[model samples]
Target: MKINWGHLNHDSAVAVQSVLETEYNFRTTVTKLFLQKLTDEMHDHLEDVQFDICPLTKCFKISPATPEPVHAALKEIMSHHLPKYKEYTYQA
Candidate 1:
């Protein structure tokens, strides 16, 4: 899945990506917990999945090889942190 956060400035897009990556590591609370949930539930399917940010396009891309369930889980997880960009998300 690709989520175009083109509406955000370069710095803001980077910040959001940083937050997600950081949260995934720490697993503190809220976003962290959700990210952990996705990691735990989709471990198998997520092996080849990648999360990348394109500063030029201001887009966040998830590997297309990810299973549909993983995609849905990602959408739900991202929606919490990026509600404003929901409309910009779509399958790649």
Candidate 2:
């Protein structure tokens, strides 16, 4: 079974995910990441770097202009965004 990890909007975002996967086994081989909109809010967070989707996405024909700033913004969110739900704790 393959599961989607949502969309990645920038090259740096792809690089970051690749690093995470190679270094941490963050996802199963069957997992996939999809790219969606690169909004202004998302772009504002990036420091200043241009980006594009990976060949895989392009080969499949998914391409877009994702500026560096948006990548940075995504990174910031990944760096500081809180978990939607808390981990479970056991009481003795």
Candidate 3:
């Protein structure tokens, strides 16, 4: 799965990548071509974003504290990148 890290800085991107790779067993390829086209279309308003993936359940959770715009952007990105999975949002 390809993660949209355009809005994230180096450390944040690496952290996310580590979780996806180690926990979810996702193999990612980072190329110069991919980096060149990175889009910060979400405006980088969000500072801290979290993702929890459950491969068995085929669902992933995004941090509830996230702003609506960033949340929507994340949902869209996750949906596009992980079409087979479902989003698990906190209901409170």
Candidate 4:
């Protein structure tokens, strides 16, 4: 019997299920009985990997931006003049 599998390298989520899925490929559909075979292999192979789903989200949150005085004035007028949800908290 030939087993078709993909290379499961450099996992970052570090989740046991994700790692096992990478290692098992389509085995879960082939046979649930032997999924443990691949899971055992994953247990021995977990390693550090850079995780970056939204790496930009971090920079955007941490970095500050200053608008020019003219732009700020326009924003102020538009925010106050425009219709907004009652739930909006920022000052116009």
lDDT of 2 by residue, 1-92 (tens): 11222244556977666644642332221121212333556434333332222223321111123345554444444334323211212111
Residue 48's lDDT in candidate 3: 47
Model 4 misplaced stretches (Cα beyond 4 Å): 1-66, 85-92
Question: What global local distance difference test value does model 1 have?
Answer: 0.51
lDDT at position 35, candidate 1: 49
For candidate 4, the per-residue lDDT at 38 reads: 30
| TM match of model 1 to true structure | 0.43
Which 10-residue span in candidate 2 carries the lowest summed lDDT?
83-92
> Against the unseen true structure, what C-alpha lDDT does each candidate score?
0.51, 0.32, 0.46, 0.28
lDDT per residue for candidate 4 within 1-92, as digits (tens), equals: 12222233444565445544533542332233223333554333222111111121111110012223422432343344433311222221
Q: How close is candidate 3 to the true structure, as a TM-score?
A: 0.42
* Candidate 1, superposed: residue stretches over 4 Å from native: 1-35, 84-92
TM-score of 4: 0.18
Model 2 TM-score on a 0 to 1 scale? 0.22
Give residue 71's error in model 2 in angstroms. Answer: 0.4
* Ten-residue stretch with the least lDDT total in model 3: 26-35
Candidate 3, 1-92: lDDT as tens digits: 22222222335766666545644443232122223333566445534445444433324466555667666766666566655444564222
Task: Supply the global lDDT for candidate 4.
Answer: 0.28
Error of 4 at 29 (Å): 49
True-vs-predicted CA distance for residue 92, candidate 1, Å: 7.7
